[model samples]
Target: MEVGQVLHMNAGTGETSYSNNSHLQKKVISMTLPIIEEAMTNLYSSTSPSSLVIADLGCSSGHNSLFVVSELIKIVEKLRQKSGHQSPEIQVLLNDLPGNDFNTMFKSLPSFQKNLSSQLEAKDAGPYFFSGVPGSFYGRLFMKKSLHFLHSSYCLHWLSQVPEQIENNKTNIYIASTSPPNVLKAYYSQFQRDFSTFLKCRAEEMITGGRMVLTFIGRKSEDPTNKEAPNSMWELLAMALNDMVSKGVIREEQMDSFNIPVYTPSLSEVKSELLEEGSFSIDRLEFSEISSSTYYNEYNHSDVSEIAANSIRAVAEPLLVNHFGDGIIEEVICRYKEILLGHISQEIIPGITNLIISVTKK
Candidate 1:
């Protein structure tokens, strides 16, 4: 599948839009605030740049996009005040796939800039500029040594594309406990390639001493197919699809051919890739458990199944629509909701494993 052309979160502020369902992402950003602030402080202390260039990779449209930039600016301003140095000009770049909803994000920029301007004015800081760069992060997105800081959340787990050369894996859509060893190897190899490419590209784009803080779905287990790993979510999703196939809504052959281009790497897998690339030095690597109940608490009135289905659809709907016709999208989601509700009702749900890593360019 051409992820660049089809992969994007649901657009607009509708009930099912990613903008509405991204509380989890917001919580993640909040959790990583200390890391982000520390990185910014270190960047400022190490070098006094006339202009600070920051990029938020995979910055899907929402309040969170500007929230990150705003927070970073505050950190820089505070440090500037303490040292009595002139505040550096800020350039914030929001990046995502080509199909991302740049319009929604751009429309909100005026107000965001106004708020940023007011905040900076109170502290005698320089002006803040915002722009959108549309493309994949697996390749170069910026000029050599142009960026000072980089941040990405809930994005790296997505492989550049699905792996090739698998056969007869009809019942699963991801690397699960039931997947063959070859399938597991294929996914891991793909992640190694994609992540190494990511680090290499960023190494060229960012200056030495630059810092990056990234958070994404991952697993604590070294085994990719651990039942408690994030792959379990995909397993549940596949079960929902299989139910549709059993009822004649979608063909079994279609299910067999479908695979999600996402992988949850273990800490060892991530560290290996970082060391192989030989560009970034790991500063911190940690895991946090995000409760499924968080989603439940967000949409208290909505059924658990409905909330889960919408959350998945926000990210996967575009890909699903590309594979299966739009005609079956609603039905597929309905069945998925029902299945997820059943699992949640039985308390069989596995909470998400979030991997937060902070690194600096060597």
Candidate 2:
């Protein structure tokens, strides 16, 4: 499947919406805050361009998107005031797929503007502007030498499109223990192509000293089929789908053919890709684990499984809907919740190890 057109977080502020259920992603953004701050600090101090151009690739819907812009604004404005220099024109560009819920995101800008006015002083404030660019970051999204800093959190693990010729890996949505050798190669190859293109595109668009901070789910081991691999949530999802098939809720072929365009690479794989591209110097590489229990804290329930499943639903529902139709969404989520309950109870689900990397254009 073409991810750019179909892959998006569940929209709106409903119970199952990404906007309401994005605490996990917010956690990721917060964990990478120090890296983002440091990069912004360095970019602002060294270049001090007349216009500070910034782009947040894969800026999905909801508060998490605006929260990033707010932080960048505060950081730059503070640096300007401290140096006693006239503020640079800060133009923030938010990029995501065309299918993203930009309307819901744009609707919240009024409050974002109001909050920004309260947070920063109006004195000598350079005019800051924001424009949404709907496109895939796997290719170029801006003019050459235009961007000063780039930030993307909880993205990049998704391939530009689903891997081809994985027909043998039936019933497994991603790289699972049961997947064949060909399936593994297909996923990694697609990631290499997609990530290499991403780096090349960004290198062309960003200035010489520009820095980018990227945070995404990655595995610790070189093995892609580890029991607790970064994308195990999808494995549990596959179990649910198979159960549905047995119950005649969905056809066996429907479940067997469905595969998400997500690939959680090992740290070594990421390093290899970056080395091959050679567009950016690696400044920092670190991984931190965030608990699945911590990802859900809305109603204060002890059932961590359902909470975790709900979080997964917010992110995966759209993709499922695009593939299987929306009629089975409720059933799939519920079955997935039950499957997760058993899975979480039987074993301690390891929290996802989020990889945070800061790189500078060479």
Question: What TM-score would every model get versus the actual structure?
Answer: 0.96, 0.96
Write down the worst ten-residue block by lDDT for model 2: 293-302
Q: What's the distance in Å from true for residue 206, model 2?
A: 0.7
lDDT of each residue in 1-362, candidate 1, tens digit only: 78778899999989878998787789888988998998888888999778999999999987777788889988998898888888888898899999888999999988887787776645567677888999999999999999999999999999998899766567999988789888989989999999999999999999999999999999888888887735766787788788888988889899999999998999888888898889998899888887777646545434667767788888788888898888888887887787777777777788888888899998
Models, CA RMSD each = 1.6, 1.7
Residue-wise lDDT of candidate 2 within 138-226, one digit each (tens)? 99999999889999988999889999999888989899989999999999999999999999999999899899999999888788888
**lDDT, candidates in the order shown:** 0.86, 0.86
Backbone clash pairs for candidate 2 read none
User: Top lDDT: which candidate number?
Assistant: 1
Clashing residue pair totals per candidate (backbone < 3 A): 0, 0
User: Model 2 segments beyond 4 Å from truth?
Assistant: 293-303
Q: Assess candidate 2 and give its lDDT.
A: 0.86
